[model samples]
Target: MSARAGSFSFDRKDLSRFLFDLYDYEPKLLRKLISARPYVCPFEDIERHIPEDAKVLDVGCGNGALLAILLASGRVKVAVGCDVHEGALASARMAAERTGNAGHVSFLKIRGFEELPADSFDVVTMVDVLHHVPEGDRVKAVEEAIKRVAAGGIFLFKDMVEAPFWRRLAHNVDDLIFSGEWVRQVKTAKVEAQVKAAGFELFESLEIPRIFYGNTLRVFRRL
Candidate 1:
């Protein structure tokens, strides 16, 4: 996590420790759980796909933990995180400043995709975002995210999978507790088709299974 050139890989423990001590949030347990998220989630796997020194954009970047880790990995030259939540944006800004990455990291407040600048990035990501979007707006949200991906750049979409009754229930419960809303599960095949229709080709699909959390990551390349 030293931000050395060409050293994008990081130890989980190191990352957890760095994030754990990075902020002082109320309700001490929240800090511990958030810091330990990488241990269960596929943050490392997601990091592996990002090319070195690529300009990155992250949509629905709650708390900006992923973007912070990406910047710390030294693989990203610049990172922009956009979200509708002002509180989360504040936390994100703090993360960047505390880590001395203020120049390379920026946060934006966007209520809708149209608010985003007309600029493309080498990598555009929407992780655990679409599901949180209202059912009617999910497709449009994805289309907008795809439009921001530069030609030949990668778009990584990560979200919870709808499957075996128990896993879906667990994710729903988690969302209800933290988000105060029920997540709408979108079908994987439909998303693939949507991306394909938008001039993107499927590059890879990865299924990540964590305890009580079944997730899938779709990697697409804009043609």
Candidate 2:
């Protein structure tokens, strides 16, 4: 499959090749992480749900890979990613420049919620971020992310699955390596209920199970 708008074009067959080229200059470790990302993450699945020509915001957007794909494949008009890591932000900025997306893409260092723009977006996504958040802050973080979704906009929530004792254990190791902390995981049911309580209606729910890593995805529409 392929998509094009303005100057952005993406061919599904070229995703791997594109990513390989995108991070070719990164260090060995980051290159490996980026290369392994498509295999381990449900990016294609998530990409299909984002609307064309949408204005997008990604919370806890590590490395900005998802934002990059949306810009390339979904014809997103503007994409912004926010995270606390400067190194990742630098890499994201480099990728945007290399792709000639600097005019349409931006990255923000989000030390506090007040740093985010007050404007709502057409699409708001938080992938694999809730689990990394401290247990006490997850709710507030979710609320903040949801608040950025404009009325009738979509909120995409994707996070590691927390179940099957053995799988959870494997994910813990994965988290430790990536996040450097043992994070608390909330059940999928609870997360869905929480979002539903926050004036969102669940539009779709998916459970993607993998050998080492699993994911739970919820697509919600602002009601």
The numbered model that scores best in TM-score is: 1
* Tens digit per residue, CA lDDT, model 1, 1-223: 4433344456778778777876565258878877887776788888888998899999989888888787666678888999999998998888777666667888999989777656899999999888888888888898889889999999999988888778888889988997798877878788899999999999889888888888889999999
Tell me how far candidate 1 lies from the true structure as C-alpha RMSD in angstroms: 1.9
Q: Tell me which residue pairs clash in candidate 1.
A: none
Residues 79-120, model 2: lDDT tens digits = 888999999999888776666556788899989654666789
For each candidate in turn, give its C-alpha RMSD to the true structure in angstroms: 1.9, 2.6
Q: Which is the leading candidate under lDDT?
A: 1
